[model samples]
Target: MKYAALTGISPSVIAELKTGKARTLELSSAHNIITLTETAPGECLFITSVNEEDLAPGDAGIMVDLLVLNISMKRVEVTSSFAFEERERMSARIKVQFRGTTIARDVEGRKWGDPTKVEIIRAACYRAG
Candidate 1:
């Protein structure tokens, strides 16, 4: 599925992709969002990611890079986010509710710190896999 790149990226990053340069966006030692493009079979962009965001005592979570594929431009168009909670020992779970390209938002509809993002992240884990 197609989704927006959630974090506001630097102009340099956008410039790199438009130039057909391959680069990786790293959030940590373990999380990476790689940018790739195809030149022959039509212009296609890929934002491949491998990330881990929720890490806490007695629980951990992992997300294999979700492939944002066959893109045509440097910027994606939909809102997306990921968050998680520990549902078991050394296990993180995102409740099976929220899914799709949505950001956790405030009651006024601001994407502040809504817990719904946890479910969205969980869904990404499963759907991407």
Candidate 2:
């Protein structure tokens, strides 16, 4: 099994996780920390981790990075007019990259004419094995 490691924490934490500047940490460290936000119940906490390792053929000991998390989004809808006019549904996709590696991806659908917002609810990271 793999574990999540804590690298750093933000000093100026925000009521909402999305509102504050992200803190950076070294990927070689190991620790776990929980971050809280001002969102609703079941929608306010976030987590992340990091680890170090060596996988390069010659390097012998290189640190790879990994990140994981869950994101939330506000509901969206398409207006009848827009749907009829464009004949397409509104959609969004998220892509995550770590040390030049694609780790995870997700897509969500949105209404043609509705306001939409998303939250990265959870995330974790570690050195690639």
Candidate 3:
């Protein structure tokens, strides 16, 4: 599974050629993984293989969420052994804050019987400005 974080100056700000909300985000500091430079605008960074032995869980599954601040520093954190019942799916709550204003959305995924086939869920950007 591949995980990624996408960041870029909002198109409107970029068009104006101003740092109205421009900032550099470090993927390693946030996700503890190498940064992926892709063509996508909204996706700026990512971490993968959270299920690997090096970072595997013992009992309960994990919860992934992105903390996006007004300054454009987006952080991805994982909480292990999060609450979940058998046959229940996993979900991520993405929160975005800009200039002290906040908005949130949820990303949901299911646990496949086969671990190898587990799908990679994306915590997309709900607001770019």
Task: Give the number of the best model, judged by lDDT.
Answer: 3
Listed per candidate, the RMSD to the true structure in angstroms reads 19.9, 16.3, 17.1
lDDT of 1: 0.25
lDDT of 2 by residue, 1-129 (tens): 111222232322212223332323322111121211112222212222212121111211111232233333334455685463323322212121222111212211133222112222123457787
In the range 1-129, model 3's lDDT, one tens digit per residue, is 343322222344223323233333332222222122211334322223233233322212212233442223334454559754334222222332222211112111222221121223333447677
Global fold similarity of model 2 (TM-score): 0.16
Candidate 2 wrongly placed segments (more than 4 Å): 4-70, 82-129
- lDDT (Cα, tens digit) per residue for candidate 1, span 2-23: 2222223344544444443334
Supply candidate 1's per-residue lDDT for 61.
22
TM-score of every candidate relative to the true structure: 0.24, 0.16, 0.20
TM-score of 1: 0.24
Give the Cα lDDT of each candidate.
0.25, 0.23, 0.28
